[model samples]
Target: MESIFHEKQEGSLCAQHCLNNLLQGEYFTPVDLSSIAHQLDEEERMRMAEGGMGSEEYRTFLQVISNALSVWGLELILFNSREYQSLMINPINEKAFICNYKEHWFTIRKLGQQWFNLNSLLTGPELISDTYLALFLAQLQQEGYSIFVIRGNLPECDAEQILGIMKVQQQQRPKLIGEDEAQSSGQGSVLEAGPGVVEGVVDEDEEELRKALALSRQGMEVEDEEADLRRAIQLSMQGKALLGKQP
Candidate 1:
């Protein structure tokens, strides 16, 4: 844990933090991303001038930011890519995932067999259990987040090397930055009850979070079943037609 490199939220630099955290280094800056965006802009304009219809996305910067990631050998594959559905169904080899909800971007990555939530909004890196990974991702998808599988090699860090041989368990979950202050202001009585009482309250909250994840997973499963049933019906109909046409 001591070797883990974490950068708390700073201004609107979540993109920078997300990338640096995934790569396990201070490898990119605003200037670098800006340079990439400029290059993309020039290329887009060139294509437009060449009589090709080019799409310009000014509503959001995600497209430009994703291109910036490519400069570092990082490729963001859509979680819902039809071509990669099998891979996502059982993501054993996945190294990292970047998620976007509206304009906010965050990353979830695996290091030394442990998964961590590297969201800038959190107070620090969150240690996520392997058992909870699929539920967590399914919940995010239900909540309108566009998840992308990060494909490429990530630079190794001290934490990864150390944890490879020794696994660490998280006793407490990471909270959003300023969460304590908000809780203190609104629930002063709860704080006065001591640390044990606080843990109880956190437990109740965690239970609710788990329930939401379970519900999301159930919904996804139901959808998949329905799709399979529809496909079977179509195939049965086609088989019947062929039988009727047989001489």
Candidate 2:
């Protein structure tokens, strides 16, 4: 049967490249899935029922990817059709397996059922963004933009640099920059739904101030409210360090 994704060039290329990389023993660990799985252990799974990883849907999905990587190769395109479908190119057997998604999911379990490690070679940014868009239901409000999730540990200064490289490669076409007037007149921008904040909300300064105000009730005998102000500034500076920002 003709796959629904047969005509999609990027999808095919991505699948092929992924499979080829896997054959060369070049595969990246899937961090997002790993994170999701940690909280879905058997005890937690039974508690949550449908939402947790214990659910049939989640387990099946995880297994399918794992098994495909183990046997055929890691490079795969999991396509959604009226029925779930998978096209996995096996590097060892030099064959393609067209299987139902559910079956593929079952197959991965036959291999080690542990979570995919995160600290291992991580997935590239483009794929990461694709995962974010799919999982988060981020809408692209404009013409040609994408979104991806970054680890909480990623430094804010480096996020843009990493994301920029990924975006450029994912979109091989030349970038076009035009005046605001162009957009107002006819140019349209593609605005993708953000991957949500990677780091916590920058409330260090505010939190510091709150703490300082609370400390005032400690009866430290501040010379005056002005002394309290100075203490607040100091506390705020300390909080700024947590955010990796200069005060």
Candidate 3:
């Protein structure tokens, strides 16, 4: 697992990190996912409009990741889907898994004969033994993660090739980057998914959406500051602000 590809936690782009890690490269970016999600959103919006209805869900999340990944001939099957469950009692013939809990996304992929947890939350990839794999998947299920089994050929990598040639022994297991601090603070750490504060995309609609979010946040901050100042002036006029005695 020494050559394991991992992307550390960066902003709320875990979905981006997860997909890229699963593919073992920088195959995706936040803008890339956003454009795909926006396309999906547009399709859903049009579909709803055809029925004289409006959309509810944002739908600018992993649904876009799934769509984008499909270009490489990768198929993601829900672990809880009846189709997969009926076919196998445990995960078999799987290359990788995309796990989501809350809005955070991560990957677990089998490189060569061993599986590795390529979670961005973790400092690095954690080695997973074959015997412990089933238990780990069950634990994730119990912890409310939606697991998607990835099927189809994955891009070849140094780790996969090196491991395929000869397996490496793990001397230590990797831990979440902020495991101790999060536990002490009584917080559950998560890197949110979806279109976020990211760079512009080539897609016109996607760029427009990202610009809207940025402008809206900026406008809100300006308005909030103006409102606060107005309130302060009003309070001084009413003799409520006696500290500076400017009134």
What TM-score do all the candidates reach, one by one? 0.65, 0.19, 0.64
Q: How close is each model in CA RMSD to the real structure?
A: 15.5, 21.5, 17.9
Model 3 residue runs over 4 Å out of place are 39-60, 179-247
Model 3 lDDT tens row, 60-176: 454576787898999888898898899875563578898765456688899888888787756688776676667667766754567889988888888898888888776654543
Q: 211 in model 3: Cα distance from truth in Å?
A: 37
Pairs of residues at least 3 apart in sequence or in different chains that clash in candidate 3: none
Candidate 2 residue 242 Cα shift, in angstroms, is 29
Between prediction 1 and prediction 3, the one with superior TM-score is 1
Q: Write the per-residue lDDT of candidate 1 for residues 130-153, one digit (tens) a residue.
A: 766776676666555667898887
Q: How large an RMSD does model 1 have?
A: 15.5
Ranking by lDDT: 3, 1, 2
Q: Is candidate 1 or candidate 2 better by TM-score?
A: 1
Comparing candidate 1 with candidate 3, which one achieves the higher lDDT? 3
Worst ten-residue run, lDDT, model 2? 102-111
